[model samples]
Target: MTIKVLVVDDSALIRQLLGEIIRQSPDMQLVGVAQDAYVARDMVNQFAPDVITLDIEMPKVDGLTFLDRLMKARPTPVLMISTLTEAGAEATLRALELGAVDFIAKPKLDVAQGIAEYSQQILDKIRMAATSHVRRARRGESGPPANFVNSGTEKLIAIGASTGGTEAIKEVLRELPANSPAIVITQHMPPGFTTTYAKRLDSICAVSVSEAKDGERVLPGHAYIAPGNLHMHIDKYGADYRISLLDTERVSGHKPSVDVMFNSLAKCAGKNVLAIILTGMGKDGAIGMQAIKAAGGVTLAQDEQSCVVFGMPKEAIRLGAVDSILPLEEISRMALAELNRLGAGTRL
Candidate 1:
């Protein structure tokens, strides 16, 4: 089936660049091009495009306001186009919270050339959005914080995600108690955005969340996110675990790759680690999750019904790496329960 797409951007250059890109894709049809939210709204209703590429910094009705309104009125899969600045990162994160499927950063210079260079990525995101689950804003509060008994053995929670991970990570972190074990996360994101994402999570979650720095000791009650464009791994130093950032080649087609992080955790923490593969668009974490399982670490995958895109988790389950498949809302609680059982010396 051919995917229909609408381009909504204030810049005429972006409209033309993206329109051409879409028109050139045999599998995608450029339904309409809107210069602002008002025109985008009409085009949306008229064309009923399968995917909408929206810009956040538009005049009159901004993308966020329009997105919020659109999601409430008529939900559709939306991909965001944003600047690579700090403010743009914040707004893009909010757009995801409001229901955008994914985002691509607008280049600061040479817009036309940049968009052309990003053509393949733009096409991939558009295709992913067309098939992804468009989750509406739940407006739900985080469940009660989990309380866990200390097992003396240091525990680690290693999480990996891509496409819809910002919200998924938030959902897991918010549900963790202040005494939860050290958490290391690898979420595929750009350099400037990861810092903002960590800060945003810190503000709302019970656990202290921050961008992981090289050689920092991993501590309980804190969630450390791998910096964008770097691979983060857990290394044991004496009796303590420390975060190690690698300026290495991309594994599984992503820097800060989930597979790298998961494999490291499996090797370093062994059975004491809880590995989770969340919603994403590729098979990045599957082999590493298998390593985790082989090392006796517990593994969990988000089920298809709850995943925005069930790619990574599905791949892990296919490899027989996951011990349990659970919904997004139930993962935190289940992880805590499993941790308790592990602490009590029960087999996972």
Candidate 2:
């Protein structure tokens, strides 16, 4: 199936570049080009493109507002293009929370060539977004059980997700109690966005959530998200496990790769870890999940019916690394139960 894509940007150069890129991809077709949100809205009605590349900084109406309306009205997959700045980072984060499937960082330099520099990557994201599931951003806290008590296991949860994982990870964390084990997440994201994603999760989760700092002791009841463009590794600080963020070479095509984090955990935390591979579009976590399983850690994967895309978890399951598979809704409850059992010295 030829993927239909609409380019929404104020820059004529970007629109032309994107159009050229789409036309170059055999699987993609250029549906339309809209210079602003108003034009984009009308183009959406007329073209019904499978995927939309939306610029955040546009005149008349901002991309976030337009994205909000698009999600509510048509519920299509949107990939945002934002400037590579702090403000752009914040807006991109909001766009994700508002149901954008993904985003690309607009180059600060080179106007025309920058867009083409990552032409293949642009096409890949557009394809993924075209077939991706766009779900409603769910809210409300579902704290673990009313009578939940600290199991005192000193264990930490390591979660990896991509594509549709922002909401999936949020769903699991929303059920965590104040005494839940520490969590370290490696979600595929760019540098300015992970901090905001952590903050967003912190606001809604029952536990303390923050972006992971290098060499920081990871405490219980706190979740640390691996910052974008960095790889997070687990280390032992006396009796406690600490996080170390490094600017290492990309693993599995991502900086904060799931395999990198999980492999590090397998070496550092060993049997005390609970590794989860959630919805995503690639196999980044599969090998790392195997390492965790080999180290006797409990591994869980999100089942296909609940996954936005079954690529990551499916690879792990096929590799015989996953111990159990659960739907998105049951993941939280099951995680809590597994932690309680693991704390009681039960083998899962």
Candidate 3:
């Protein structure tokens, strides 16, 4: 079945360019195109498209506000098209918070040349968005959870994700406590974005969050995000686990892959580790989670209901690598509770 899509942008040129791209893909079909969010809403109600490519800037109702309202009322997969400017990046991040599944950076130069360069990226994002598991926003609910402290010897939590991971990771990390376990995260993203993302998370999360640096000690109450274009792993020397940043080639088609981190944790931390796989577009972490499970470590995957995309976790579950499948809100709590239990003499 062809993936049905709706394109929403104010610029006629962009709409035409995107339409041509969508039409070229054998597995995808452009159900309709809208000039702005108001018209997009009507198209959404009529076409009920599987995916939507939304431009961040529009005339009447801007993409972010429309996306926010759309998610609150009728949640569906949304892929944002944003410029490379700082303002555009900020808007894109806000769209993620509003529940956008993925995004593509708009061209900065010649329209045709830019489209030619980014066409594959745009198509890939749309395909991924079509598979996302978006949820409608609940009325009067507060933003994602706050970080809390962890009191135990386990000391660390490691997470991995891709595709729809940005928003999903934010939702999970935000709930953690001020003194939470030292966390190592590997999210699939380009170089410039991960630093911004880490900083963004740090501001919202009570714990100290920063991009991982080589040989940095994994201290409790802090989180280290693997930098883009590098693989991050954990290494143990005596009682301390330190971050190891690698310039090695990409594994599983992702530079900062979940498999790299999970494998490292299995070898170094072993029984002392907790690995959680959240929403993503592919199977990067499945085998690594299996390795962790086999080494007497605890593993969890986000369940389909709360996942923006069920690809990674589903793949892990299929491999029998996951010990539990919890919703987004429950993952952090479950991790903490399991750590507390294991630290209290309950073995996996």
Report the lDDT of model 3 for residue 110. Answer: 64
Candidate 2: lDDT over CA atoms?
A: 0.85
- Top candidate when judged by TM-score against the true structure: 1
Which digits, one per residue and each the tens of the lDDT, describe model 1 over residues 90-147?
Answer: 9999999999999997744454455556889899999999999998876979768877
* TM-score winner between candidates 1 and 3: 1
Give residue 40's error in model 2 in angstroms: 1.5
Prediction-by-prediction clash tally:
0, 0, 9
**TM values, all candidates:** 0.96, 0.92, 0.87
lDDT of 3: 0.84
How far residue 125's Cα lies from its native spot in candidate 2, in Å, is 0.3
Candidate with the greatest lDDT versus the true structure = 1
- The residue ranges of model 2 lying beyond 4 angstroms of the native Cα positions read 108-116, 139-148, 344-348
Lowest-sum lDDT 10-residue window in model 1:
107-116
The sequence of per-residue lDDT tens digits that candidate 3 reaches over residues 214-279 is 999888788899998999989887777888999999899899999999999999877787899998
Error of 2 at 164 (Å): 2.1
RMSD of 3: 3.4
TM-score of 2: 0.92
Pairs that collide in candidate 1 are none
lDDT tens per residue, model 2, 1-348: 998899999999888878888899999889999999999999999999999999998999989999999998999999999876778878887787789888887644465565556887888889889877787666664645422354554587899999888878888888778777889999998887788788888998888999999989887789999998999999876677888888989999889899989999999888888999999988999999999999989999999888877899999999999999998888777777777776633222
Full ranking by lDDT? 1, 2, 3
